[model samples]
Target: MGNRILIVDDAAFMRMMIKDILTKNGYEVVAEAADGQQAVELFKEHAPDLVTMDITMPEMDGITALKEIKTIKSDAKVIMCSAMGQQAMVIDAIQAGAKDFIVKPFQADRVLEAISKAIG
Candidate 1:
């Protein structure tokens, strides 16, 4: 089966950007979430092969939601997304069990690379 990805971002544009990247590269987009809370809910509902999560969001930030998702399934592979200079949050996300991270204004190749690294 193709790898399933759940995308999370507060901005609809950002979510679309990610979806465009993943779909063209043969990854199945299982769902999209506008915030981390929805991300966790989608994770439960879809049980996707991977997740691309945004760090800055309303209604539960990425790190907090990452922790919650980890509680549900420790083996869940999550790759975090952040804007430049969000180093502390990125570190916290890794500690919370994220498999990897991507910096924003994303590069399609880099995003795919991270997803491949996480899922494979």
Candidate 2:
């Protein structure tokens, strides 16, 4: 089996887009979450090899979720996703334990590169 992944995004289309990219690249999406709270719950439930998390969300926001996930498993691999101008949050995410990050209007190659670099 390929590396398992959990995707967290508030927008349904965004989640679908990421899921498509991952599945096409031979990654297995074990679960999907619409908010950071769900992301945390799903992370615990799935224990995926890696996670793709959105920086902003309704319930908890990615940074908090990332920290929570880290507390659950210190070595958990997470990659934050942000829109065009969220560089500050991206830095915070890295400090909070995200392995890397990807920008929106998602580029297939960049997304794949970040995931591969994070998990491999």
lDDT of each: 0.92, 0.94
List ranges where model 2 is wrong by over 4 Å. none
**Can you give the TM-score per candidate against the true fold?**
0.97, 0.97
Candidate 2: clashing pairs of residues: none
Per-residue lDDT of model 2, residues 1-120, tens digit only: 438999999999999999999999899999999999999999889899999999999989999999999999999999999998999999999998999999999999999999999887
Output the number of the lDDT-best candidate.
Answer: 2
lDDT of 1 by residue, 1-120 (tens): 639989999999999999999889888999999998999999999998888899999999999888988998989899999999999999999988999999989999899899888878
How well does candidate 2 match the true structure in TM-score terms? 0.97
lDDT of 2: 0.94
